[model samples]
Target: MRRILAIGGGGFTTEKEPSLVDAYIHRLIDKPRPRICFVATPSGDNRAQIDKFYEAYGSLDCEVSNLPFFNGWGPNVIPYTDFKPHLLSQDAIFVGGGHLRSALAVWREWGLDVAMKEAWNRGVLLAGMSAGAMCWFETALGGPFEQGNYGVQRGLGLLPGACAAHYHNAHVSERRVNLLAEMHRGLIPSTLAIDDFAAVLFEDQQLVKTVSWASTSTAYRVRQQNGCVEEAPLTAVPLQESLIV
Candidate 1:
């Protein structure tokens, strides 16, 4: 079954304790030393994102490669092979988070979206944090921070309904609330809000698991009840809760 392990936030580039979430993602591939690829196209293939990816994945018992789409990509993605083949070669690919609108625009232009869907069908786990996570859902909330308003953005619809990242963040909690309110107003049917360090996992098309890098993290299922927003805490199992395999 195709799977998506969408992380809300928290990782090498975002926080100090990034290892837990990254390590958990590797285990989900369930292979003895899998080949993991980093897709940094979202962040304009930023060097720092790639650097931190290696910094975290380097010590793990797996082979790591990167797909850089900006500024003359490195040998891993360009001058080495074609697009679809590169995506299919790995056991998993982790997308770096950045501007969602810009990322999707670039991906579609290069047909990486089509390639990723193919890779997902081939059982390569599609995973990411923030914008990376939100894009997989049918709809997502995107905000103009300066204006303090958010609106729904269409996603690839690999998963249904709307999705929210950084649910409990200090600076961004208002955005999350805005999305929930929109859901209540019937602008969106339902929404899934994931706190930093938490992830909601989908196996095939069914949501089967919620895991967190930190115990404090929580996942929420949000919807409209009567004329108001309704929210319930999802049971998110911490990554340290048990042995993955």
Candidate 2:
């Protein structure tokens, strides 16, 4: 009963195609009005980005609330058991982009990930962009910064294997791909690289469809081990076609 929309990078507010966002919202909440919890790690420079997200969905009948983990003006808010009930009550949860490692670390320490999974199992809509999207996979590509090539940090594991975000964006360069390819060698799984403005939808624990801004995006199924690499374009394959069982 879990419905997840993992956007590559661009968010509903930034994209010209607002229909994609609208459609996902409606699907997540059957009613005309739904309560949405906006989870963000508000770094100093992300105020504009966070505000843009609110502006996009503010008009809807939904009640939107911002739950920021990193309070720039104050100390970090550790995740606590007291927040569990409030988290479960949300109809939809939208996560914002930021330092993926920091975000995951805080989420795990506070047990927000566990609480989110419980909410999803009880039928909640989970959506996000960039770093938010990366959390859905088992492993995520760290950053383009000096944090060193890639970090195989564990994710929510909602979907198995690893995912590379900002596929065609300048942040994820060819060098980053090469590093990921080398790191994934001998792993008993495949990796998916999703380009900006693209998204892959999952329902009932399977990939339902891949959507993007009309050829502006690409999806790749990459397999590698011991320096050998093989990759192919991911077609609009049905969820049933790639069952891992």
Candidate achieving the largest TM-score? 1
Q: What TM-score, to 2 decimals, does candidate 1 have?
A: 0.91
Model 1: residues with Cα > 4 Å off, grouped in runs: 73-75, 79-81, 145-149
Candidate 1 lDDT at 84 equals: 74
Q: Which residue pairs collide in model 1, if any?
A: none
| Candidate-wise lDDT, in order | 0.79, 0.67
Alpha-carbon error at 113 in model 2, in Å?
1.4
What's the residue-level lDDT of 48 in candidate 1? 74
Those runs of model 2 whose alpha carbons end farther than 4 Å from true positions after fitting are 12-19, 42-45, 72-81, 144-148, 170-172, 179-189, 225-227, 236-245
lDDT of 1 by residue, 79-140 (tens): 22376787788899888888888878777887888888888989999999988898888886
